[model samples]
Target: MLRIMLRHISLLILTLFILSFFSFSLAYLFPGDPLVNLTGIRDSSEQTYALLAQQYAMNDSLFSQYWHYVNNLFSGNWGLSFSSGLPLAEEISRSLAASVELSAYALIISFVIGLPLGFLSGLRHHKFIDYSLLSASVIGYSIPVFWAALIAILLFSVQLGWFPLSGRISLLYDIPYDTGFILIDILLSDVPDKEFAFQDALRHLVLPSVSIAIVTSTIVLRITRRSVVEVMNSEYIQAAYARGLSPRQVFVRHGIKNALIPILPLLVMQFTTLLTNAMIVETIFSWPGIGNGLIQAIYQRDFPAIRAGMLAVSALVLTFTITSDMVIQIFDPARRRPEDATS
Candidate 1:
């Protein structure tokens, strides 16, 4: 197991090394001078732009600058934003909590609703319940996320007036900043200031969260149903049934554990996908997050913000993938041999 982990870790490092160079180059590949773009120096004298570019080190050769960028990253300097002139780390830190909060809520809802429905759908097989669940899954998977989010807002917020139309919270409320997450802040605070803003933020989150959840839940539902069905036919399951164990007992005790082994990797991958989706959803809802920050950075041609955000997202996704792989090795019968356990 240790060897396997070390091998994966090495591969992860290599992958990131390659990815960092490519991500950096792609941002630099665009036409126009970086400093000129930053300063909007079009129509200025060539000498003026040249001086500023040299001052910002943009006049350095691409290879030299890229090598410096890599060295700085290793030395723990992530660089500064061209847009706000703030440290890239600080900008990302400010937005990270909101992005994580949105993704966490969507993931929780996906698993909670998807897993049980999937299990029932698999257990029922050809029955009406199974058909209904499958149909819902298909619809959920087919709908475009942005379209679904807009429709949800139209129906829930516009027609029904049941939820807030946009933004994280009402401007009127005095929301405490213990944590960047509005919901968490509300939970930890006194009730007096929590009324409008807390509820408003939550209501605003629902459409985007549900839109993300619905799309992602399809993958979970389908994978879970298939895995459960396969587990239901395993030798141990048959033996439990032969011993006159109740259907429910056999399903819970003998089936779920085995079925989930294959599902764990996909579950972890779903969180990464949820984060990507949240980018678009956050923009639509005007919720301030890494996605919005990235967009703003891009428009301003801020290389540091782009690189830092890209690196941050890359690190997070890889971390989840590594975690899932480790979990899989632990639970998977084929991988959990004596040799694996000892290693």
Candidate 2:
């Protein structure tokens, strides 16, 4: 286990190093001037321009500039976005909470909606209910994110007025940004109508989260059904059934546990993807998340912010990949060869 973990850590460091270098390289390869973009000022005086350039080590060679940028990155001076004229590090930090909250909510929604449905569909396997559930999942998977988000906002926000049009909470509540997450910050503060404030945050969260959840859940539903079906057909499951155990008892005692072994990695993968795949929903919903920030950075070609966002995403994926692998190996002891300890 130690050997494997060490290998994963080394690989993670190497991957991040490579990603940082390539993402940093985008600044030089892309069109337009990096110095002007960094400062966000198109018409600075000659002296101010010179001073800004010197400050950012823009006069350095490619290697020197990257080294300087990385040094500053470690020190938290992640530079400024040309679009918003805001510190990239601070923007990323702010966006991180919103993105995390949305992703966590989306994952919760997906699992709550998908897992049971998938389990039921699997047990019924070729029956009407199973087929119907499968069909619904297919439809959910096929819906385009941007289109779904727009339709949701129009119907839920405009016509029904059921949910807020955009933003994390209603403007009426003046909840302090204690933790950047509206719900958490609300709880952490002595705000009036605390329950109401929490509910409003949930209301604002539901539209985008549900929109993303639908697609993710569909995948979860299909994969889980397959896993359950496979596990149900196993010899031990059949033996349990033959021993006069109730179907529910057999499922609870043996089937579901085995079925979950394969699904854990899928759940982790889906959760990791939620962190980055939420860009369109965030943009449409006006959620101030990393996804939204990345989109703005892209439009203005804010290279540093774009690079930072990519690194964040890449790191999320890589970390999750390792986590999934470790979790699987831990859950299924068969993968952990006993001889490895001796070697």
Write one digit per residue (lDDT tens) for candidate 2, span 1-343: 6766676678878987898888777766777677765656678899999998899888889888889878987998887777777787788878877898898888999999999999999999999999999999999999987788899999999999999989888889998776777788998999899999999988999999988888899998999999999999999999999999998899999988899987867787887767765766899898989888888878877777888888777776787787677666656566666764444
The local lDDT score (0 to 100) that residue 315 gets in candidate 1 is: 76
Clashing pairs in 1: 1-343
Candidate 2, run of 10 with poorest lDDT: 334-343
Off by over 4 Å in 2: 41-50, 334-343
In model 2, residue pairs whose N, Cα or C atoms come closer than 3 Å (at least 3 residues apart or on different chains), thus clashing, are none
Per-residue lDDT of 1-343 in model 1, one digit per residue for the tens? 6766776788788888887787667545656765544444568787887786775567688887678767866776776777677777667876877888889899989999889888988898889989999999999999988899899888998999998887787777767767888898887888685666677778878888898898889888998999988899889899999999999999888788888877867787788889888888887777778888888878877766776888877777787777677667766646665767776
| Whole-model lDDT values for every prediction | 0.80, 0.84
Candidate 1 deviation (Cα RMSD)? 3.3
C-alpha TM-score for every candidate: 0.85, 0.91
Off by over 4 Å in 1: 37-63, 74-85, 174-179, 188-192, 195-197, 300-304, 330-343
